[model samples]
Target: MAVTGISANRLELLQIANAVAQEKNIDREIVIEALEEAIQKGAKSRYGAHHDIRARIDPKTGELALTRHVTIVEDDWMPEDELEEFNDSAMVRLTDASKRDPEAVVGKEYVEDLPPFEFGRVQTQMARQVITGKVREAERANQYEEFKDRVGEIVNGTVKRVEYGNTIVDLGRGEGIMRRDQSIPREVFNIGDRIRTYIYDVRPEAKGPQIMLSRAHPGFMAKLFAQEVPEVYDGVIEIRAAARDAGSRAKMAVLSNDSSIDPVGACVGMRGSRVQAVVAELQGEKIDIIQWNPDEPTFIVNALAPAEVSKVVLDEEADRVEVVVPDEQLSLAIGRRGQNVRLASQLTGWQIDIITESQDSERRQREFSERTTLFQEALDVDEVIAQLLVTEGFATVEDLAFVDNYEVAEIEGFDEDTAEELQARARDFLERQAAILDAKRVELGVEDGVMAVPGVTGAIAVALGEGGVKTVEDLADLATDEIRGGYEMKNGERVKVPGVLESFNLAQEDAELLILQARVAAGWIDASELPQPPEPEYEEEGELAEGEYDPEAVFEDVAPEAAADDAEVAEGDLEPTRDA
Candidate 1:
């Protein structure tokens, strides 16, 4: 603070620089540079604004030097800044300088030392302001450098203050902010109270680096467990996934590398000591430590614990799982306000739809009735024959039309002749349906080129035309979300936007394939440039034994022939034919 004038004692200047640097936790060299700039600005005011004044401070002795510079330039030289006109005090023309000194050349600087002067009131204030601003900038830079790489770390601090529900934390070296949304609900921190937070993010801004802190973050809980559980900290156990409905409940999935160690029990500890420590830090929030399973369905079932899942049906293509529980457990499975299912979905990375056993049975019966009715009407068969076909998993007319005659003939109480007759009727019905859909597509202004796309059938063409995508180019321009239905925010509410192919029940990948094929047919891309499906990864042998549960067996229940039938049906309800 003894920066009264450039003529101040040399030791006093160094002492001031050292004090400010130490107090602000910045480099001494930075403080000296700041002082030099302040002196330069004061000198400019004292001499003349047009003069090129420079100041330097010797680091060891803190000796101040002030000088005026005049640079020799070409006769036709233009100022680098267009707004700055030529200054005779700062620059001398090369020809004029050559006349004054025979050896004078362009780019040469002439320096003249000036006597130092004491600071006047106005100059002292200006110097103080400049030094303060520069020192503040240095301090910000140092703080950013210190904390930027410390993200994802848990740190302890004191509550500095609160503004509008946001708590400012006073870290030992830098400050951090815990926004209201990032704090546990009902938690309060008065000034000077001790607190702990996770550094989720650190961002540099015009004001300063924003050190973002959070107590509600899943990482905060994970790190606290790591700190309390020696196995977690030592990497013997790993926290695979964590989901939180902060201050109410949380679900954590943990796995162990060592086969003998039970990850869940280890995390629970004796008498719930380990988990209790973490729960205490989290304001007594309930924590469910479940063992992680490599199988997604099993993991999801584990995630929905204490409710007891009766069954889980997975649609891997859509990354959705349907869970059926007992009627008594419906509310428990869904939790209060759907919190249990929401946290389970988050922890397992799947969309879950929970249904009671009665609902599942009702849905199954409805689907069977619908399929039986379709077969009965399409094949002109009796209720017995239609019910038999529906029971055999013949989902659509297209399936019966394309299935091998031998497979149908092998059915109970059926022969080759009956199988041949049923398939003939099935094909005839598909042909008639295709004709009707084709006529509708034409009426809707669908182009022939759209039918040429590899995956497009008459039914899909009609649907696309009805959706105002009549041409292949139009289909090519559409996004997958437009083909597969999705929700969109409209007027502060989420509204369902029906897809052009939503009725077809196409998987996300199937919708993507339709667009890619359209793009190829429309000359937007070459078929050769299309992405090839990845080759199946080869797992290690000797992994599975007889009667063992294989995660991949979820899809194995559907026979290969039935799967193909269902896949073809999903492509389009109508049979494949070259004729549009």
Candidate 2:
């Protein structure tokens, strides 16, 4: 039989605890507590199962103590019926406990000392198991704390083991795992291979800390450049943005604090040394080091380097850009599979629509004709007046109706009187359009609950009604992803379907508010000062409950002015109360 391996002298327990803590890289207090619990487990095994055995290890001298503890309780606190079944070993009444020690009080613990027992095989084995389990738990906790905040940082490690495609890297203090998908495309790992990776996430699992590593993440490329290029590390060169397509290609935009040093060249190094190093590490992935400019168009031009842009049109409100490039450079600007323009879009943080010069010219003419047709039919104007209105950027009747008097007067041939006359016509046209939409909404059976959604226009409400979400509860039931294009099965395979909001081209923030309003309307959510749905109709003893819901009564709490404010197209001072 195996004998206990613990030292004979009790004072050596403290020395053993300190060594275990150092070896596990955990706290000494935690190790000492583990030792005490391990010893207590052994005492419990040696003593009877119901005995209240305890153990303590002194922090200073490391002296060991063992005892049987019982708690003193007031008998008056117990119920009268079950007092006979009270546990004598676990608890003693204050009256009985005070005879042993006159100072004994309720809630105080009384201890009886026990002689130290020999470490038999069973008791020693139980203690060893308890110590191992507790120490392992403390080590896991300490490891999680050490590396949880080190996410997005570059860490170097040696491949301790490779299981299939996954790599377990020994990162000095603790092991970090690099999953197969997180690695750069086609990159292979081997046991004993040294690797550097970016810490992407540190998920705390029930068992222990899960350190997720990634080389394909955009931050990895940025950190690599920072390591290779001195200027970037020192803040002389700032990396404005970075985008990665993994081991295929990557783009980095850099700006220089010193006017003399070209940021692009500084990152490129002497004859392509600095970037080439990063490229080799990334398995020959190409890197584009572009000079950064604060001007958006200028930045876009730099980002799309080697491709000349002829013209650029920006729709700021829409967060979109139309870039017109020379016809010959069209294919070059839009690289293999549109990679160049795609990276430029990511680097610029804009939705880019790249078009050839001829394509843009054609689109402009098409838009002008469409706007001209809209103005002619809506305002009952002649072709000449309609063309002029279209040329002045009055795309919709609502735009013309809401224009400042001075704005329309500034349009080439229109005076203040003509502007006012045009404005009045526009407002009249919109009111008629609104009336038509109201009739259409009724035809579609859109509920008042759908209409009350803040950002939902008449067209959006119609779309929702036609899509079979005609009630407030129906709209509220939709998930955010469902409202912003979600996956569905089509032709026996999963595919993404366009959402109702996609057809209306509603802003994301507006879509969120509409959902919130729908939830509020359905009584699923509450907002301060906003309308709330009526209480559920419960049947009373003598009276029957109302069978149908009336939204007017449901939203009776909403202010009349607030309801009218959202219904009107224009807000506050801009509302067209009169003919204009």
Candidate 3:
């Protein structure tokens, strides 16, 4: 009867471990380990705190084993902390252990079986805390492992609770949090409500793994479309980009791999059934589905739908575009509070400046007048000749001076002699201007070494000198932003801080190159440390020469043709042939 009672008690222990492992969704081995640790702690209390007690449980059978061990060490062995005395109960010097066993060596442990004992109230409490703590640690580890690789995935969860404005969601295997900013505006969830969210991030924290969930993330909308649209899920149509004004409006750019299918039409679905489902999930947020184009300007045009764009001028260096629309379409192009343009900018990854046709015309005329006046004064040409040169795309005296003489001679009503006279005047003017700038640079106390740096022109040297960057060392110390201009917030308003070379309109890359060159000239960095430009890729064999391949020129030639094709398609006369 006593044997039967002992067998039942051991079976009950196994049953408890199994149940806890199953309930916590942790490994059975981890649970068993926790139990062993708890039993070991209780044994130490039962015997003596100075004893080195350990416990093990047979996973295959309901059996517990407790033991006390003393490890043999060298005679010079000391405690882990040099300041502390050695623990004789847990560790024995080899000389002492050899007296008991002649063959005893360092790391050899003498073990003794420990008799099972009932736990006192204090011991019971300590064991319970130990078990709870170990089990919780195991649960956290399991949770982190389960969800760490699940970022960028959409998840459905029950609303567990709300604290402040944040919602705690009970995912089946883990808990996720949707902070107030992550939740869609005006969206609310009650406890026990089922909600869908995107797992944007998962972080392992001291307390537990934090699964950060969001409904406002653009990825959430893209994933929803992937769920509602079979083509999106099957990869027949790919969502290239998405942007959201959350609960108000959103835009998605999609491309179809198969030419027969229109990406926008497929996403819109049959009578908007598919998009309607997504809209319902998002609490009636309006979605704009547009076809993606490899041509960035064309894509930007598509992104800014429901309004017409007359022209788009892109500055690739700045990732900025100037968009011109009809005067009557300005309001529609910009949308309420600039939301349309803002979403378009986000979708197309460009800074967009929308202007009316009249505004663009006025600005163009002002620029033309300024350039004509510049040519007339710099090259000493008459108004008609200057205007003609400006019309022929000669904006600077340097362009007129260094261009192939044939290009200028080929201009209407211009001969070789006239072109030669213009080139000669342009060169003489540039030389005089350089002399003036050099004199100004000297007057401003700029070092000649600053001018000697690569990429530093005489005008730039004078400009830097005026800005107090007179020496190569001073220029080297300047940041890219100090040369390229940037914006800063002042009293809650963003204000543009003009750079030293702001008038030169230097690109960020160019500014960085200039500073690096200055650093090299100042002996601050080696010339070899400068970043090398990537080698231009060429078509195979005889298609094109390596040095002749200019991507910007290629894109420029293709953009107008692409834009024309887009117009023909809008007119229902042509079909797009570009690949997905």
The Cα local distance difference test for each model comes to 0.87, 0.78, 0.84
Ranking by TM-score: 3, 1, 2
Global CA lDDT of candidate 1, please?
0.87
Instruction: Give a tens-digit lDDT track for model 2, residues 496-556.
Output: 8878667666666556767888888788877764545569988555532222112112112
Q: For model 2, state the Cα shift of residue 567 in Å.
A: 40
What TM-score does prediction 1 earn?
Answer: 0.86
Off by over 4 Å in 1: 74-87, 101-106, 403-406, 409-421, 476-499, 505-532, 538-580
In model 1, which range of ten residues has the least summed lDDT? Answer: 567-576
Comparing candidate 1 with candidate 2, which one achieves the higher lDDT?
1
TM-score of 2: 0.80
* Colliding residue pairs in candidate 3: none
TM-scores for all predictions: 0.86, 0.80, 0.86
Off by over 4 Å in 3: 1-8, 46-51, 78-85, 485-498, 537-580
Name the candidate, 2 or 3, with the larger lDDT value: 3
Report the C-alpha displacement of residue 451, candidate 1, in angstroms: 2.5
